[model samples]
Target chain A: MPPRPRRSYDQFCAAARALDAVGDRWTLLIVRELLLGPRRYTDLHADLPGVSTDVLASRLKDLEQSGLATRRRLPPPAAAYVYELTGRGRELTPVLRALAAWGAPELAERRPTDAVRAHWFALPLLDAVALEEGLVELSLEEGDFHVRRGSDGTVSYGDGPAPDEPDARMTLDAGTAVELGRGTLSVADGVRGGRIAVTGDGPLAKALRDG
Target chain B: MPPRPRRSYDQFCAAARALDAVGDRWTLLIVRELLLGPRRYTDLHADLPGVSTDVLASRLKDLEQSGLATRRRLPPPAAAYVYELTGRGRELTPVLRALAAWGAPELAERRPTDAVRAHWFALPLLDAVALEEGLVELSLEEGDFHVRRGSDGTVSYGDGPAPDEPDARMTLDAGTAVELGRGTLSVADGVRGGRIAVTGDGPLAKALRDG
Candidate 1:
């Protein structure tokens, strides 16, 4: 099939070019979903909530062409097509962090029209995990996800509790997590108020508790 | 007048919220234009080629409502409406940087449809300035601009040479600058190639020379 045309900015600037590739609607959020690891199409649609199936499929194809993501059939027993980010695609961790930091204040209140998901809260709280390398399982009122902050600087998270024992584990409500993410509440303040719970004897746990 | 509705993802996640504000077409490019300091509407139009007037106006209005930009008339002597980024809006610098860093490699070739502006190159090159807190005036074959890398980690640059004496001055062609921005070439490599000419004995200049 002929590729879908890209509505590029047609600018020589790097930022403009980046926007040309990922500036389309739902693209970065799709990146957010895959950052958690490989996900089947249905899982992505479930987490994203509002994107149209056609748009999702189009974006996945675009991401694949842009070399940001890849799609392949899973081997054997649990076979299904899945999409995952390439190393270059995973480099958006800092961009995600910056966006989360910039937008945390805007999240003062959830509108009646807003959809909620627990792992949706993961990107904002990823930086707070503070582990140089290791898995940190997060338990939230809505759900749980284990974020693996790599020493190489890519941050990835997967659904459910940590598959293996985690380096650190944190439990907090969405409300408190947002507050902490926004700096409306500090780590020490969250700990003092019992809004945040930290476990595990690892440095990240100690850092979270002692902060 | 009633505000135009925001086409949000309707997701409560902060990154999603941010995307709701910025993910629109030309919104961030507008931010990019304003980051060089206040710009007259016509000037912005000139610099941001390929943006339709209607789209520009809409993006500007959206930016204003989202608190990323503001519009105001200049004082009597040089009166003209100008748009500038708010402090909160300027916080996207890191996001811009990360995007630039990630997208730099894609700039391998400028397409036939691509437009070029000397200042458009400033944002990606801002970080290579290196000093903790200093101004580095860059003179390129296409034009000149000065970048101020603040101690607080904010990188802002403007058109023309530095208003005051810069800590360092470097003259290079845009091709070499692109290489440096893309990470394919280092500042040290550029200097060694004599593609870059650095002046002034300030720490930044000395560091660039030493590097």
Candidate 2:
């Protein structure tokens, strides 16, 4: 990428550079809420009730200044303002979805079922992305699990038993499988160590290894 | 967005939901750091020196579970992990960039220049989308300000005297112009109120109205 004019930076690391803008806890969550649609200030406040009005105002100002959101006045005498993600802001949906998917299982494990329902803003991003063709089914005798595609390039998590005719199959405990999905451990290594098992096409098996 | 799979409500939004399988906070920051390139865990620790080893280990687990990053075991049996973003994780570059840009000005205002530099991950997204083409020069008595569209679609902000061959001219104070950029007031309103003066191209004048 070419250098941004006027903005000066001595650091060479890109991630550090990115953190300089969004490292705050509220900002990414705000981006996540905007992915759903344009919202009024009160609407955003309701969605993220934990955020103070002042902080929301500041974040909105920052977002507009950075050109991620455009704030427009609504029609009539309401004097209300609507904040919509610019095209640039909308592009962040995928990152938020992937992050949500990665976090869901742990979230499920931590909270009781009754409490999770209140979180309207916490939906995963994959739900918004178009799912790709081909399905993979896997079953374990004992475990709670979710699946994410290495090849489909859409990161998501699902509940319950895998479909009957998936393109491939792998069986492992929930935690270990999630670890594999995260790319922390290689499938080949896991298989060699007896942490995971395969029961499908050899090519698909190899593909998992490659992933 | 599709409904979340069967589970009760509380499970949905707790810290568990927010926390990735890799862990929370630090992992995302670590991934944001690696999105630029690979780095040793110690180097990552340096970027976020406040994080303890136990916390770092936990965060690495969560990041690995999310597939946003990968840890390669390097040579000589050193048992060290060098982390880098995966193809999926790299997609977050723009999001990180936007956050950096949003935080930069405030970080500068609050902290000394020598404090950790503000990262600018959002610049690419801004350059890719928000910028509009064409030059609109606003000439003030103190000095002229130029807003021009770059080939890449980024809006350039510069300070200097007016150019001789200007397509249009508008006289306004710098502070008011910045306020307009914030969407707090309208340029046409300002002009009608005699706070600003416009000359030259009619279409350019209209563009400023829209802006």
Candidate 3:
């Protein structure tokens, strides 16, 4: 493919240089999606609703050019293309986390015109959950999702139900979920106050309830 | 002023929301400028070269609408209009700092076409300086500028020479300056190794050399 034009601020400042790479509209949001794991083009298109096909393609190309993401094809039975972050791209985790924390208060109230998806809550809640190594199924009015903290210290979340029986299931109202995600309320406070109903007999469930 | 259209990823995620506000090109760069202090429209334009008049005006309006910045008139003798970051906008310091630290590696080499202003180094170097409460004049090969750590703990920098006799003056090459700003080289290390020459007899200079 021909290289798309490279847009830059052209300043020597580090922050300006960083912005030159990932500061465009929907670029970081695309990063947010890829951060979950590799996703097929269709998967990304579906998750990121309202993004025009052109913009998505352009941003993905930009990411590839910037060495933040790459396009790869699966082998054998799953011979499909997917986009994933590069090691340099994965380094954006902290930058995304910082932005997520800073913009948490903005999520206190959702606008009527706003569009939300199940996994949109994943990043913030990932930091809120204390499970060392377990799959956590979360149920909210918006939708159902699951969070997993691996023994290897990697955390990831997905939409809908857990692929397997979860170690813990948390059912809570949207308000409580928003507060917890905003970090205004702790998991212990929610569990003790009965805002979040924790279920399952696993150690993760027991630890959450004991909090 | 009329409200410009607000572009959003429409996702409920906090990072997405932040990108909604600051994800636009030149927005965070403008935020970086305001972090230094308030400035007139002309001043911002001068520092931020290559930004079209229309885009700059549009971004300033976007910032004002987002409550990140505001415009106000100065008193009497110099009754010029200036833009400054609101308290909420100032909260982006950490966000900018994170981006700066992450993007520091990208600044390893200056592109031939890169445009740089003296004050561009101010923000990154702000965190590198060890002055508790004094004015620090930094002389780089690009140009000279000053950073001040006020008694109130507020830090600010300006282009050109110090406004008054500065408390301390340090002269260094652009490479060492970039390393120090990137946090790879410590101030003490720079001083001890003579990469940075500490020149003033003030307490700030004494402390810097003792390191």
Best by lDDT: 1
Most accurate candidate by TM-score: 1
In order, what is each prediction's RMSD in angstroms? 1.7, 17.0, 3.3
Q: What is the C-alpha lDDT of each candidate?
A: 0.85, 0.51, 0.84
Q: Ten-residue segment with the worst summed lDDT in candidate 3 chain A?
A: A123-132
Inter-residue clash pairs, candidate 3: none
Better model by DockQ: candidate 1 vs candidate 3: 1
Cα lDDT of model 1 by residue, A39-72, tens digit: 9999999999889999999999999999999999
Scored against the native two-chain complex, candidate 2 gets a DockQ of 0.11
lDDT of 2 by residue, B57-168 (tens): 7677556656767889778767676887777666554444434433333332222332242222223222321224555555544454455565785443333433445445
RMSD in Å for candidate 1, one decimal? 1.7
Tell me how candidate 1 scores on lDDT: 0.85
List residue ranges in candidate 2 displaced over 4 A: A1-10, A110-211, B1-26, B29-211
Interface RMSD of each: 1.0, 6.5, 1.4
Rank candidates, TM-score, best first.
1, 3, 2
